[model samples]
Target: MDHIEGEPCQDIEDCRLTDRHVQTLLNREADELARHFTGTFSPETVRDCVEDSYTHLAATARIRTHLPVLAARFARQRLEATAKNQGATMSDEPEVLFVCVHNAGRSQMAAALLDHHAAGRVTVRSAGSAPADTINPAVIEAMNEIGLDLTKEFPKPLTTEAVQAADVVITMGCGDACPIFPGKRYLDWQLDDPAGKDVDQVRPIRDEIDRRVRTLLDELVPSNA
Candidate 1:
């Protein structure tokens, strides 16, 4: 069995995470998260958003190691989404949703690379048919080498709203579970799963995702646009 330090479980019997404990986790991540949302939020406001995000995720998480980081990422995504919606910038870009079985490995990597390469010209979202408790550590390590941070990213449950809102939907492994709507382009990527793989194993998958993302971006957003 794997060992965990300072496990977030208050009562081993019920394994329910307390609000105070969750806040402690959020507190540890607030300052760092502020750097990512500098103009959009203050440290205190980022903490509030992270706290809310942590609370929502803790309700469904089965593992605790990745909780704090995931909360920060989700909060950032929420903040960005809200800002784009209010500023009317959402209409200027194509929204893409990536789906996989766990939303922890392939989907996460693909979304991160796409977001990085697009540089605000594309809106990216990722979810899982069955979300995992935490993202794969190996996947995190692989992305870290390329200066991409996955520490704040979490596996989110797939929602109909996400599929409907996307201009393009890419499935790494998740199948029929992804909803199909008219006027949306769909692509299925047959890539190797990164779950349980070491950093070396994940590197190739990361590289492949980067390649595919660049191709997809070229098709969606022209250089002149």
Candidate 2:
């Protein structure tokens, strides 16, 4: 589904962020560096900061990305910096996506890992270019060892729209079936799939994904400035 659209902002009543308004104009985003501050600033504080930061950033630079929200984040540091000066008004965290041949293994693990580490600081989702009927049983077993519940999640089909909706698109060997759009950065992870593997084998893969997920989270959205 399209996350945000080009709807004109009509006062605060229309300011909750709709798909239409969010994509309409490419305003100069505020220059704030999120990396400068970290360690659980209150939600209200972050929201305000992100808003003010985006305002300044929208005014300053041109973001290059097919997805509007995704593009908006490259300038995320700029927005955070602006908000910090004003004392904190961060709003909205970036969205992350994971992809693999089957949404059942690698992608699923990666998404869960990111979400677990980030708490509610980031939004995480995963899908397949070609989906499976359900997530891999072995993968699920491995994650459960760490106490994450994926019972409500399901395998989903991949769409260009979904990829465009993400700030980052991580592909686990999904070469050609996945298209490359302009203004998008791509990361190819060379990980083995655990679709038919036993829990012993799957455990190592799960641990690796979690480690990578934690590193990516820090590098991309560090809590400590």
Q: Quick one: best lDDT, which candidate?
A: 1
Tens digits of per-residue lDDT, candidate 1, 79-148, equal 6655554562347679999999989999999999999999998889999997777899999999999999
True lDDT of residue 119, candidate 1? 92
Cα lDDT tens digits for candidate 2, 88-176? 55446766778998688899989998988898888677777766645788888888899987655555556555565566788998887
Best by TM-score: 1
lDDT of all predictions: 0.80, 0.63
lDDT of 1 at 36: 76
Candidate 2: C-alpha lDDT:
0.63
Model 1 CA lDDT for position 149: 99
In candidate 1, list every pair of residues with a backbone clash.
Answer: none
Q: Candidate 1: where is the Cα deviation over 4 Å?
A: 1-56, 59-90
